[model samples]
Target chain A: TNVDASSSNCIFHWKNSSDWIKLNVGGQLFYTSRTTLTNSDPDSMLARMFSTSSNLHPGCIDSNGAFLIDRDPRYFSPLLNYLRSGSLILDPDINPKGVLEEAYFFNIQSCIPLLEPLTIPRDEAPLS
Target chain B: TNVDASSSNCIFHWKNSSDWIKLNVGGQLFYTSRTTLTNSDPDSMLARMFSTSSNLHPGCIDSNGAFLIDRDPRYFSPLLNYLRSGSLILDPDINPKGVLEEAYFFNIQSCIPLLEPLTIPRDEAPLS
Candidate 1:
């Protein structure tokens, strides 16, 4: 489930390849980043975005130097948005910070945080 | 994400309610019990099956215990299957018990365990 608080748009569904079926809000579906999209190889960039087969979860900042986010899918860093030259700002209703915190409490780490400067309140800034 | 080792089939996808999109065998979709099911509704049975709205999650074994499985949708007891009653039997390819065990280890209690005696091997019987 890719939730863009920035756009207040949430995508909850399955993946076959690069194709995505948009989820209608207020529906019951579980999103888990599962991907081995039949049409796209595991090496493909789109595959990287949502594939659990790799064991290299998207935002994983490993001790090893093999990171793909900013380069391929630009994971963790929200590196995708940064390169595109825009912010992945969130909305007040979604509360990206708070939502992720709650999800973390449930131990769902794969729920990637999409924090963009546009959405952070004027009173807040990313902590170093 | 509905996984039936019964068919050695795993369909992980987003639901608009009645229609289910299929997921790849080894992919990431993050299946949660999420559903208000826009195409469906609060009163619809299909909506009841997969929705997260209305504060009702599927298969909730509760303290007060006003449960929903076995009647309208058949819940905690694999109510959905008993109705069809063909036996939503599982297959050896997917070890339902062990998978739920590991998920439980990580505090992921939502991964539903599909236990049909056929797949449970002759020695195992669900503890009452």
Candidate 2:
């Protein structure tokens, strides 16, 4: 398929593949955050972030200090390197539980949609 | 049962009623927040609160701009006054979907337990 970035939806090439899959601009995120590796104190940064941070990361959320953001369950899949090691650039499953709790409270609709299929365990949904 | 506060649970009294059934300090919240609805501007306060507010209210959480905090499902119950009106002290179901979403992510164990019984629609439970 002759696809280009100009359109809201298009086809994109796959690595070492001859065919392209349909891509929707709105279906997925377009931007990514780059947390530069610095010699700064990791402990201090985590503490400061937990106390008060905008997004856990770029697309991450926090629910106090108890829950972290479980961005995508597919990320939890037992395939890629993230399954074995925590060395991925955009591993969304590395936050706290409070953060996820926060998500449940605020965006009930959106949260439900995103969480139900992610195959989250039944014990974690929390009381309404 | 000669219930007492000294116990892990106990019985309490009411200002109007003569007899007391039972009370569990942990079962229900023991404290509340005093916004001190003083001579403060509702607009600016809300702005400041939303942009960088921790806990939309007591026992409240935030997701993002798209969703607010929804504390409890029963809180959404129509009765007493919060149903026909909107003036309560501890309304739980008043947050955002994103907050709930966060809960689904990190604390899938706890989230599923609380959210499931709350009767959230299936469509809302994301593509987990």
Candidate 3:
């Protein structure tokens, strides 16, 4: 039965090539994996876009078939990296407040706490 | 005089949309800018690939019109990031030795010294 199940799994999902996903966020292009999007936050809009049964699946695609997201590319970069590494390090030029807004829009709950601290003014920030 | 020069500059290079370049590196997608590649290392192969007068302009392109570079996507990620920012940070799972080899292949001369320290064995590494 175990051997039969393993063979069935391969048969059901034979197209391994589609695992990589491309996106045209704002004007910048990005490439990531379906596993990263779905596993990062199963409840988020990004996860829903890749979900076959979800209604939020992208309605727009670029000429290259990359999903089009009308969000700032600068903010999206860190968010995507966060999903990949679970680390939310941002470049010095990136405003934390902007990233926080993107996290909220994407509904990446895991990132909110991590970003909130960064958004707080230095004077009011907790002594960590 | 300044206004006349600025207007001629705009006319000569009026197409703003083509500044973004996409690449399919080892089946993974990447989005970057012509400025990033050309400015990173004017003498590097990457810069040559984007040069209009250079023979190395990509001969292979994927179905999505992204330049096809047959290389390890894992190592390419950090290199791309390094080009974007002057920093050479790597994820814990990424090997510095692999990144060094890629930097050499790509002819990114500026990155060699920054990466050499990370590739050295702990005992042989110079103290900061």
Candidate 4:
């Protein structure tokens, strides 16, 4: 669990006690496995945060010991779903624009195109 | 957080440090607030678990310190959403029947009616 202060590349092993991870997004809580976070997009912020090469141990932690990510929970929920199911299905009340912003912040490149079309208003001035 | 062994009523003050709580449902992790768990259905198991009158302190704990609930995480996701938004929207790939069973298990009476209709097959052999 020790980190070399002088090295730019952090090397640490993922905890083997459990594959499941607890997350606190903004003020909301979410639980998912390490696989779900990294498998979706290896380059995403979430993936990098939980990956073995990254130093996630020093991240902000909630009272419950869950890693804290400062992002809107409402938007983060749908992104978690997308990571789990590989589909961009948002609840009717959820704003696609909000989810889109979160997707970009998380570096989830795959969800951008799926969300971009939904963000556009159908009533927009038809490309005159 | 003391529970009178002789009296069934358990008296406990919810931790004041954070309204947010961590949950581990059948190995899956989730983070949510105490309000979201109880506000939707005051009489449900989740509400009772987080309620001041219930004995939730000694419940199972995960390695990361999340309260463990032994339930199917798949179906639990939609129920969590229902609690959040009071809407019964399910992903296209999710089974309505599964969610219905989970709703019943959690004693979410309000969601049962919404899910029942969705569970019935419209193509069923005309009521012989």
Best candidate, TM-score? 3
Q: Which residue runs of candidate 3 sit more than 4 Å off their true CA positions?
A: A1-61, A64-128, B1-15
- In model 2, the fraction of reference contacts reproduced equals 0.00
Model 4 chain B weakest 10-residue run by lDDT? B3-12
Q: CAPRI verdict on model 1?
A: incorrect
Q: How would the docking of model 2 be graded?
A: incorrect
Q: After superposition, how far is residue A109 of candidate 3 from its true place, in Å?
A: 19
Clashing pairs in 3: none
Model 4 lDDT per residue over A1-128, tens place? 22222322111223233545778888776766676787878889898888767664528888887888888987887678678656565544568899999989999999998988888888873574
Better of 2 and 3 by TM-score: 3
Candidates' RMSD to native: 20.0, 22.8, 12.5, 11.1
* DockQ of model 3 vs. true complex: 0.03
For residues A36-124, what per-residue lDDT tens digits would candidate 2 score against the true structure? 11112223322223323324442332332222333442232211111112222122333434334433433323233444444455677
User: lDDT per residue, candidate 2, B14-65, as tens digits?
Assistant: 2212111111111111111112111122332222232234233211111211
Q: What's the TM-score, to 2 decimals, of chain B in model 2? A: 0.19
Interface RMSD for each of the candidates: 19.7, 19.7, 13.9, 11.9
Docking class of 3: incorrect
| Per-model DockQ | 0.02, 0.01, 0.03, 0.05
Q: Which candidate number would show the highest lDDT if scored against the true structure?
A: 3
lDDT score, candidate 3, position A76 = 81
